[model samples]
Target: MKKFIKKIVLFLSPCFLILCLIVVADPFKVWFNYDDYNSAVTQNGEHVRFKLFNNNKDKYHFDSFIFGSSRSHAYKTQEWKKHLKDSASPFLFCASSEGIYGILNKLKYLDNLNNPIKNVLLVLDEHCMRGNSNKKGHLYISTPALSNESSLEFYKTFVVASLNV
Candidate 1:
């Protein structure tokens, strides 16, 4: 029993150290000022991520949303809104090397918003999908109502990824 315990500890030690490193690196700290802050919040704690989510129904609401990895960061929300000639929300929930699973996870958050989303623009980054073939582009499909399948699948993937790291 002691030997078995020791082996388990040895195997998990490196993983624990890596997790500590990541937390100390503070990836989210620097990103707070990036697109994440802009899209998710306004001057105060007011949520500005979606123009049509709740308060500003009388005015124009965001009919479209952008979904993609960090490479998609190059596309600015104001520029996209101008180009499309429509109110569209730009999401920056993606990270480097993120795959379809990441995109799906982000959509799950939108699916829980108070207001409904009408359209979504998913950016396809070539490098992320290079070796992935079984990609089902339905990761970003969402409904206003919370989906049990989507929630469970997303949480499952998140837990697995977090631990596997």
Candidate 2:
């Protein structure tokens, strides 16, 4: 029995060490607060944008938003503000590869926050309009906060992904 236990420990030790490294290193920036993320690793821009908005929403008090995939980046906030009331504080709520579900969830999240959504500009392409489900992969998954997904599962997905490479 003691020999069997030793073998079990030996087998698990590497996995335990890898998990520890995942927690400490946090290559995906999921476990720590960061000023900026590594650009080389494609991150979930949706999660990053949501974190930024959630953290600074009170300070900025954004009332207007531009929502879409990377294409939305073309619409400058300053330029969009020109069309809205002077009191409008516009924010860009874009994702790397946004889908319709992502856009709806973001809107729902803001509504839940009781945020005054004064104006919205939605830039959509064929793909954005067609997609009806949350994307998979670490770089495309919607943020758990907005998607109402289990936080554990979200982190686990990243941890598993990190292990793959």
Candidate 3:
């Protein structure tokens, strides 16, 4: 039994170590405390699917935003730019199964960016209104840190989701 326990520990220790390392390193910048990360930690590794608008808000000087689920992906940004004939470049912030709460969270993050939001294209679906707003067990990938909620439940959700990732 002693030998068996030792072998199991030896095998599992490395995996535990790697898990901790991932939590700290956070390559995708989706989970963990990014505040500890310095400029040396590459911001370019962010998962762009749901985070594009938040990650690159300053890069495009975007005045317009498109927020919705995966269905909204078909609406090309350039098409809207041509239709509006405005200087504001469109940024599509969409993800699979994105709901109303997720869209609201994105808008909140955009507002926090402190840039003027002149135009918004919101493509929504029927499911958005039926469920609880804000979150549904890591269904969407947007950062909870953006919400500025510091309660245990908030931390629990993020940490649990991060650990799952």
Better of 1 and 3 by lDDT: 3
Candidate 3 residue runs with Cα over 4 Å from true position: 1-12, 20-50, 137-141, 149-165
- Sequence-dependent TM-score of model 2: 0.87
Ranking according to TM-score, highest score first: 2, 3, 1
**Candidate 1 structure quality by residue, lDDT tens digits, 31-141:** 123334432211211112222233343454445666665566677667766766444654333444445655554466556554456566677867656523223222222
Native-to-model Cα distance after best TM-score fit, residue 43 in candidate 2, in Å: 0.9
**Would you list the C-alpha lDDT of every candidate in the order shown?**
0.45, 0.87, 0.62
Could you report the Cα RMSD, in angstroms, for every candidate shown? 9.7, 2.0, 7.4
lDDT at 52, model 1: 26
Candidate 3 lDDT, 1-165, residue by residue in tens: 999999999999988897677657665455533333344432321124435555565687878878777778789999888877567788886755667767776677767768778888988889756524554344443454444454455435545665665
Candidate 3: deviation at residue 138, Å?
4.5
Off by over 4 Å in 1: 1-63, 85-87, 130-165
lDDT of 3 at 10: 99
lDDT of 2 by residue, 1-165 (tens): 999999999999999999999999887777776767656666778877887787778998999999999889899999999999999999999987898999999999999999999999999998897668778888788878888887887888899889886
**lDDT-based ranking, best first?**
2, 3, 1
